[model samples]
Target: MLEISIKPEVLGYIGAFPLTNAQLTSWLSSLLLIVVAIVVGVNYKKLPSGLQSIIEMVYEFFQSMAEDAMGAFGRRFVPLAMTFFLFIVVSNWLGVVPGVGSLVSIHDPAKAVSAGIIPFGAPAVMAEAPPSADATVEEQHAYVPVFRGGNADLNTTLALAIIAQVIIHAMGIRTAGLAHHLAHFKNPLEIVTELSKILTFGFRLFGNVFAGEVLLTVMGSLVVVLTGKLAPALPFGLVGGAIAIPFVMLELFVGAIQALVFAMLVLSFLSLFVKTDQSASHH
Candidate 1:
């Protein structure tokens, strides 16, 4: 069965909190970043080269943008901006990678129900169950993917948005003084505008990533169905894969763009409030 879950599938739990696949992906992305940062830090060089060069190039590009928007003060924020972009881009790209979603673990329906992983009413799924598995056996086993897109889950995106907004507002208060920053919020329109940014930041990323996941899922499934019907014995996997190549490439580009957009939005908001202080200082 083809399962398209809007909510992330639960992988396990930490005390009372259920750990979803999206959370797992985010943790993986964070770990990868930490490892890379450590490697680059340990191998520090006077003149940039290889991975260091690539990292320098991207960091410098973002730093320039930050400085352009908020003057020298913006340089201090490039780290935060870079963190947002790097984490999101990696999470997005990982979603499109083979085996991220392709790999799965089979669960016996009875066991899954007892384990509280799935409801008895839910249809069983199989990523690639073995042949010779009887109908009775098939009904007993189900697929629970080991990985899923991080941003495809709303909880992750909303958390990002909330964090960005909180930091942005905190920066504003710190830079402009609490009285000055709160004065701006006195305007009902201003308050509404500030609140609306959370929705914009969260939903925009969530919608794009979730839509991409669904598109790839549906496209791959359609290709399989068509190939199987049009040419029996023609490996549907090969045909489906070939058809998905272009979309996957497009998703890679889209993922990068979305990440950049998110980072820029955060910086833009930061500048919006921080600039008030800078303007006052200039006068």
Candidate 2:
């Protein structure tokens, strides 16, 4: 059976907090990056060579861009822009990692359907009513994966967008002054424009990652179904794993592009403000 969830499913709770699979993956991504950074920093030398040299060059590229874009604020901007790029890149790539989507939690289907953890209908393409208490034995079980792509969840992407927008509008205030920044609220359309940037940021990442996830899931499912007849002893829709390789590679590429696109867009927006300020200062 294939399960596709557009929304991140809440797996459990910690005190008052609701823990979703997307959030879990995001935390794992952050932790992994932190550990790697610690290891690298401890061994880090002033002079670069090999992979270290390559990494330093990449950092210099972004650091230089940020400095050029924001001028005085660029140094401050480097940390944030770099963090967003690294975190997003890792989160996107982690989606295609083995076992992230394969590990499943067993649940009673009636309970799963009732809780909205699993949807209605057979193999569940179409929505229907929940199964009754006395449902078929086959329908009594559900396999819910415990991990998902961090950016695939709207909440995660929207939160990142919200943070970026804060910096963007703050830059507007600083470069143009409070009077000019507040003037944006005078026009309802301007207010909407401001709001739209956040939505655009959030939805763009979420749509790409979520669509990729669905594509991989459906593709794997289709491959398994087609091959089931040839390997009848193997569980239906469980034997074909090799067919998804190209797609996994494609997703990895897409993930990197998305991360770079997001970082560049933020840098571009900041640069526009810096240019405006510089022009105003000259006049």
Candidate 3:
């Protein structure tokens, strides 16, 4: 029999996390980043080569983004901003990798579905074999995590948000002093302002990244369902694949943009305090 469609079921597994897809993607992205850092460090050299050239371009891009957003002293925030950018981009791109949500081992209804170690039954969306028909089997079985992607979980994105807030506040305090930083919470007047900032940061990041994932999912589903219907008019599967390609590429760019936007907003907000501090110091 044809392998049962498993994409939705695998997606459901990813959804079981506390955070949304964007967050989960961020976590995977962070791991990918750590690995990349190690590789870059290990292969550092006086003259840049193929891989180094790409890394250098990334660095320059971040430098340019920072300069445009945070001005001359934007170099101060480049490390954080660049790191965030790379992580987000990688996380977003990982979602488009082959077999991310489909090629996982799952239950076989014709044979016997087995439970996974996670205490939940694996969604038998796809089956390698219809289970061995000849033998008795246990009710539950350990299934491996076959399909995985970075941006599929909300926890990862939220973690990035938390990190951004922490770094932003820390930088603000360092630049403007503890008293001034705490001033963000002073009085009901300030509460309204600060709360708005917090919500804006959280929701903007969440909405953009989550929306991208949803769009990709919907498009992918449409292609899967409609390719046959549209086959005669065009090379439906090929066209669908082509259409999906650009979105994944767009996600890569958007991820970097969102990260840069988040980081720059933090820097800009903190810099505003710097001006306040200097004015107060003069008095």
The regions of model 3 sitting more than 4 angstroms off are 1-28, 64-74, 105-149, 184-187, 223-239, 274-283
- Candidate 1 wrongly placed segments (more than 4 Å): 109-141, 227-234, 276-278, 281-283
Clashing pairs in 2: none
Give the Å error, residue 66, model 1: 0.5
TM for candidate 3 is 0.64
**Candidate 1 local lDDT, 6-61, one digit each (tens):** 88766554544566678888898899899999999999999988989989998999
TM-score of each: 0.84, 0.79, 0.64
Q: Which prediction has the highest lDDT against the true structure? A: 1
Global lDDT of each model? Answer: 0.80, 0.74, 0.58
Ranking by lDDT: 1, 2, 3
C-alpha RMSD by candidate, in order: 7.9, 7.4, 8.8
Residues 1-283 of candidate 2 have per-residue lDDT tens digits of 4567787766655544557779999999999989877777777888866656766776887889876776555666777777888899899999989878765454555655443343333553221223453432223235556789899999999999999888987887887788876876787897787789899999999999999988887676675445443232345335345567788898999998898888877887766554364455645
Worst 10 residues of 1 by lDDT: 131-140
* Model 3 weakest lDDT span, ten residues long: 1-10
* Backbone clashes in model 1, listed as residue pairs: none
